[model samples]
Target: MSRGAILLLAAFSGCLAAAPEATAQTNTGTAIEAGGFVNPLLPSGPDPWIVRDGSTYYYMNTQGNRLAIRKTQDITRLADAPEITVWTPPAAGPNAQSIWAPELHRIHGKWYIYYTAAASGHDDDAHRGIFVLENAGRDPTRGKWTDRGQLKTEHTGIDGTTFVYSGKRYFAYSAYVGPDSELAIVAMANPWTLQGKETIIARPDRAWERQGGRQILEGPEFLRAPNGKLYLTYSGSACWSDDYAIGLLSAPAGSDPLDATAWTKTPDPVIAKSPEQDVYAPGHNGFFTTPGDRETWIVYHANPGPGMQCTPKRSPRIQRVEWDREGRPVFAKPAGSALALPRPAGAP
Candidate 1:
């Protein structure tokens, strides 16, 4: 055999032997088939964020403060994998406590963690901002992360993510406006600062957006459709209500995503709470591409029963994205009615 091939095979075989316990777990999440759909793989936490790096998957969520990290070659095993507390905030500061929506990204040969945090027990104190954590180590899964403080923006923001297009970098975030909470976006010159100005991207115009007594359009997530349209998805309504769901907006690829005028909001929500299956508060999601780009999947959080109490009951769930002929995103609920439905592919 070739020397290079032999070395690579030896390394993989060594990992399999060393982590036999991990390899032994084959589709253990309430499913009859191995690697099949299983919803609510994680029966706790919310605002799920997942990053698939090669065959490995790293996952996290809005656990209030503590930043948890789970690494597994197979995402299906994440349900049982122990989450390590990779980051702890300072004793006191703007990001001292109440961290939320932490998304990990590998940028410029370094690991960058984007998240929102605020002072303890203070909602008004919450700026809904973005902060960076850098890891210089080659393997992001094992590195010392240095907190880079908050991103510079004129207003409060959250659900921050970085996207690279046309050899340029940009940041997208969600925020509130006026008395009602709304999701918006701003172009960023760098990871730590917002450039130009903020643009009101989405609001609670659709019925699903106003699911509960209040209205909301937060958790801005940007993705390009197969046909090359810029699509933005946001969580809507109050998380305290079962009516909480997700909204969608779209525009041309070259259009200014930061310009409110350039984008268009769908009259109806693309994904919302599934009342039929008793899956409520289905929003705040992350997207991932399957190996070989064969499929696109969604990773989000939901309340299996009802109500919006953010506790151990609100766990992370995932499903595959089924697109319509019109080139829009359509979300599906897990099949079955007895307990919860099966999880989507690639989730634990």
Candidate 2:
């Protein structure tokens, strides 16, 4: 790292103090009444995910014990969007509690939600894994969610996300591998089931990713570059650590996603904590575009201040993706929470 970059990272390594007012403000009654909006789209939301279907967007986040989704036509006004508690787990079962990182995706005209859950009585991270739910309705907020059981994997996993490349589909997730939680991918038999053996493509090999007292590479989200390059962005380090940031793993176009050697990890985090902007531990991200706008937007969660770590203090924030000559995504520093940014293009 450059001397300047090293200094910046050093500044964010500790828990700096911040006033509560520094947190992003929320506007409830007048949604999108202004031409711009501030960060922390909502007061608190972690492991945020959004999938656009038709003209509406369905948003989900980690809500322990149950799953809920927000329906919004204008994402800038997400605070005022209608939300439905889509599915609540039973009082006791394998997936009864510790609900986290729910992602809603539509495939074959049906809606599927993949999330992390564990046995109600278990406290070990070893017991935590990914599970799926299926809904056969046009509006996910108003449908019966059928439990599809846990996604079979050799290791415990979380932050499951699915994508299609060429003509086949694959499931990407974070699997617990010894001391490090690594990113893994597997072929899918259907929207809810993994078909083959899981392949560990990325690990917490860098110093930046070894923060939070544990090595972690979770929250796998995919993006296609302007060229044929493919990118898999994931959160590194523990969510409670100030060093938590995002890393990237890329593969050549048309390469087999199941082949572990095909993917390459970037040495530095593609995005990291912006202490200057009071954005701490910015990671666990997803992507979407506006109803008519083609510009890609990246959505994730972060703390407004230091020492907040892994609490409800983290909130959803977004910025447009930038690119370089090689078509690799370039992320600038996160915007200050209080500063107003143009409401996502074409919203409301």
Candidate 3:
């Protein structure tokens, strides 16, 4: 092995030592008689998105053929949470295949799910687009998710998410621009429609983003810091490779989100592969705060080893996120799969 590989191996071993009691077994497979839990809140899942409403935490993931959500009081027990199928595409329609990255949001007291899907028997770039579903009921898992139709965009896109800033709602998504995929922003007329032209905010220009021969930047999630600054976190590089990681972009709180010049990109990845921790390609993350906003946590998916190739083996994991003295978010190195972590605050 190369000298650098050897050094990383040593580092991985050291991280394991700090959490010697960590285990990779499913929640039921291991007995938890303590205050913390091990890595991989679930046995198998990918592109995980989680949100907290009231006392319940609702989790969703890319299930290939349909949309399913898991509800629980404690995120550590996600593996034991009750999952319900909320939406299924028609047998042969524009959104009948390749469902990916479903994000649930509550706007104006109604639930909205923005997701990506391709037509049946079609996986081409032209057939993929963003779609929306609405649920008017109080509880997302128990309500009827009505089809809201496809969200119009300039080209093929995926990983759509929305955020409201300065009294105006905006949408950010990853879309195809020629041979490459880049992050774009636009104004939203409502939860399901985009107005005006998209401004390409972030492109895969850095070395890490070009890894695995697929210059991709997708999965844009919004984060607002306590200092009143707006930050956009996205996954970079090819998901099919171990180099897949998370990158950041920030803008002033009052600035227009659709203005590309208003945002600045991080030179390197924030959350990435930690060889020492045995976690690879940790990206496609979502953030949620504990009840009363006492703590913040990042929920994402990663493989146990290199070359896992973006399969269901990429399981969901969570860890607490910290902030620097300047109020910027600080994501520590990815935690090893066996590392024990405290459950979210106020979790039962």
Q: For candidate 3, write residues 1-348 as lDDT tens digits.
A: 532222122111100011222332334324355566777888678889999898888999988778999988888889888789988889998999778889999899999998888887765677778999999998898879889999998877788999888788998888988868899988999998889998999899999998776788988999988898889999988787799999999888677888889999988888889898789998899999889888888999998888876778888989887776666887766776555565678978
Clashes of 1: 6
Q: Which stretches of model 3 miss by more than 4 angstroms?
A: 1-33
Model 1 lDDT tens row, 1-348: 532222112111100011111122233454445444445667676778888777677888866657888887666558766788888887776787657788988777788889887654443423346788988886666779898879886667567887765456677776646546676666777666667776777677776666545566777777777776678777777665677766677887677667678788776656666666567777788888766666677787777777544455667776667666666666654322333333334443
Ranking by TM-score: 3, 2, 1
User: What TM-score against the true fold does each predicted structure earn?
Assistant: 0.83, 0.89, 0.90
Superposing all C-alpha atoms, what RMSD in Å does each candidate have to the true structure? 12.6, 7.5, 7.2
TM-score of 1: 0.83
Best by TM-score: 3
Question: Candidate 2 residues 225-281, lDDT tens each?
Answer: 878788999988877788899888889988999999999888887777887778999
Clash count list over all predictions: 6, 0, 1
Q: So what's the TM-score on candidate 2? A: 0.89
Clashing pairs in 1: 37-343, 38-342, 38-343, 39-342, 39-343, 128-157
Instruction: Tell me the lDDT of candidate 3.
Output: 0.81
Residue 169's lDDT in candidate 1: 69
